[model samples]
Target: MSKDQVLDPGAIAARLADLPAWKEADGWIVRTYRTHSWKGTLMVINTVGHLAEAAWHHPDLTASYAWVEVRLTTHSAKGLTEKDFALARKIEEVVGWQPGLEGGALEGTPSDPRFAYIKHGR
Candidate 1:
């Protein structure tokens, strides 16, 4: 819950192996992408719907013709946790987001072409 406490990289890495696109942020994990159009956004949403149902976890999503932003956090944990990291990884796997991208809650740059710009949010 408190950012002051550090999460163990080994344990977190094990849980995050399946999720390559998501990354640890200050308090949460996130991913973002550009959709081809409005319909593409709907398609992405529908895909996430199935993923959410399967994982029984959901993310905060904002979508438009050009972009979709996904943020995952464990509200109950009040900060990053195993659950949050797990979901973050899963989303990345499903969406094909590369790690160390700017879309996460941490600071970094990405060399991928899908994202025009990626950044962390408060």
Candidate 2:
């Protein structure tokens, strides 16, 4: 979808909330993750890289020794949209981190595969 189409906040919020701990501010969706170390963080970044490339949508990423922050917005749209929500969901799925949960799902494990269902959902 073209990024020019703005999304309704109410509808977008409903979808984003289910994507773990993403927050909305200044018309951007933000999520921060803490990794074990620089190596782990890079791994996460690399994984996200492939996902974003495949989706043909990109996020604003900031990474350090142990943390990675992602801010996503449809720049062309000047706001949120189904594309943004969909990307956020994919990211949350791949990273295996959920905001309130005691722990994140196991990455690289065969079970709880979110990507496996993405194509079918579409």
Candidate 3:
């Protein structure tokens, strides 16, 4: 099917299998990223904003002191589409990256609670 076409429940489920943190709900694909503080929340929001803008597909965001929920759908298509899934993957990658785990020169946020940022899943 075309990328812009609305995905059926079966297709959505298959796609979601590749995105463990995301789910289909109320015609949208959603995911919530937990952070350590307001600062981390803002960072998550900004990161998503940049990704959405770059992809030219935006998502609705709900932010709290320590979390940000992203809801994405193809407004024009009136349902979930490839655009939503692609953007979701990009957002997931950037937001969940742990440079420290890669043993790269760039150390991720310090392990100390005071310096912690995103609460990455183990």
Backbone-clash count (model 3) = 0
lDDT of 3 by residue, 25-79 (tens): 9999999999999999999999999999999999999999999999999999999
Q: After superposition, how far is residue 105 of candidate 3 from its true place, in Å?
A: 1.0
Local error of candidate 3 at residue 65 (angstroms): 0.4
TM-score of each: 0.57, 0.73, 0.97
| Backbone clashes, each candidate | 3, 1, 0
Clashes of 1: 3
**What would the per-residue lDDT of candidate 2 be over residues 47-122, giving only the tens digit for each residue?**
7788888998888999888778888888877888777888888887777743334545534323343322111111
Q: Which ranges of candidate 1 are over 4 A from the true structure?
A: 1-26, 97-122
Sorting all predicted structures by TM-score, with the top scorer first, yields: 3, 2, 1
lDDT of the candidates, in the order given: 0.60, 0.72, 0.93
Alpha carbon RMSD to native, model 2: 8.5
Among these predictions, the greatest lDDT belongs to 3
Task: List clashing residue pairs in candidate 3.
Answer: none
Give per-residue CA lDDT, model 1, range 37-119, as digits (tens): 56556656777767877877677888877677777776765655666665665555555543455366754334454533422
Q: Could you tell which candidate, 1 or 2, scores higher by TM-score? A: 2
